[model samples]
Target: MELNILAVGDVVSPAGVKYLRTMLRKLKQQYCVDFCVVNGENAAMVGLTPSHADEILDAGADVITLGNHTWNCRDIVPMMEDCPYLLRPANFPPQQPGRGWGIFETKAGPVAVVNLIGRCDMAFGPDNPFLLMEKLLPQLDTKLILVDFHAEATSEKLAMGYHLDGRVSAVWGTHTHVPTADCQILPQGTGYITDLGMTGPARSILGVLPEQSVAGFRGELTSRFKAAPGPCKLEGAVFTIDTATGRCVHAEGVRIHEN
Candidate 1:
């Protein structure tokens, strides 16, 4: 049987959550998605809040993954323990509040979702994701595994894809907020993408107002960053996996703009 999984990129701002509320279900229905995972670290102004997580879950996301900004909202630390479906980077110190991976029941059977953060150029400087995966994979009971690799460098994301090629069903990159055109099935049957882009304002700079982003880049004093107003766009990928073999048969990038 073929299982369709929809992996959404970082959700930024309240506008991003609004977009999901309006379109996520339609997207799932349109694609006949069997499972859905969303990177929601940016669901709030900087990091996700408990309410934002609830909003995404109510909007139809089956699993919510986070990255470096996982602790941006201090309140979410405790909420993580209560919400098993929400995952923080697995490489975080073992004492962290939330889990890095979990097996969830889906129409296609049990599917394992692992969340990891890249060490290169990251603020958290978590452990090596490649080595962490090597340790985690041996313990998972299901072959239908999906990984959300949140990193800044394209090289790191690509390296990870190759590192876990045949071992997981798919490895989708997040955090860059800009989508790449390299979605394809790896030589070993893993569906890979450099980045899934982001679900938020299409005109802004990584979901922040263009002027705000430019000010930061130009070394000019600027106020706190805020989500840009106006139309929002959703970016992600859909992977078609063969459940019997736990291999990706097809992968396609998804881009939707609010009409």
Candidate 2:
């Protein structure tokens, strides 16, 4: 049996959420996706609210993963505690509001999903992700494990992919918002992608207003970044995993442009 798992990039702003509402279902159906995970930390531009999480789930994500911005919205704290489908970074200290990984029942059986954040250039430090994984892997009961490494450095993300090569089914990077072209199965059979890109404004700077990002870069300090206004596109990748072996046999990027 083969399962097509889709991992979407960070969704930025309310517009990105609305765009996801409009496009995700069709994309899943088009790709024959059996399971889906979406990074929704930026759904509210910085952090997602409970409503944002709900909307993303309704849009088609089986699991909603978060990143460093996980706590930007205060309201999500309670939701995080209640929703098992919502995950924060596992390395975010044991006392955090929500879990960093989950095991959900799928047609192929139980699929374990792990969410991790990186420490390199991210400004804040969580527990070491590599060390956390060592503790996490032995605890997971399922062979079909997926990891979403939300990190800033490409080297860090690539290193993680190699480190977990044969251990997990697929390992993908998020948070960069820029799609990476390196999509392939590692020598150990784990599917890997440097970054899954983002599912938001197509013509903006990482889902932000171009002018705003430009101004910030030019030392023109702004109050806060705003999401760009325009047609949105969904960006992600689909990994075809062999359910029997819990290894990826085929990997490819999937991008849907709003017409």
Q: Per-prediction TM-score, please?
A: 0.99, 0.99
Poorest 10 consecutive residues of model 1 by lDDT? 119-128
TM-score of 1: 0.99
Model 2 per-residue lDDT tens digits across residues 1-259: 9999999999988989999999899989999999999999799999999999999999999999999899999999999999999999999989878899999999999999999999999888799999999999999998899999999999999999999999999999999999999999999999999999998999999999999999999999787888899899899999999999999999999898887
Residue-level error in angstroms, candidate 2, position 148: 0.4
Error of 1 at 165 (Å): 0.7
Positional deviation of 37 in candidate 1, in angstroms? 0.1
lDDT agreement of model 2 with the native: 0.95
Q: What C-alpha lDDT values do all the predictions have?
A: 0.95, 0.95
**Residue 106 in candidate 1 has what lDDT?**
89
Candidate 1 per-residue lDDT over residues 37-99, each given as its tens digit = 999989996899999999999999999999999998999988899899999999999998999
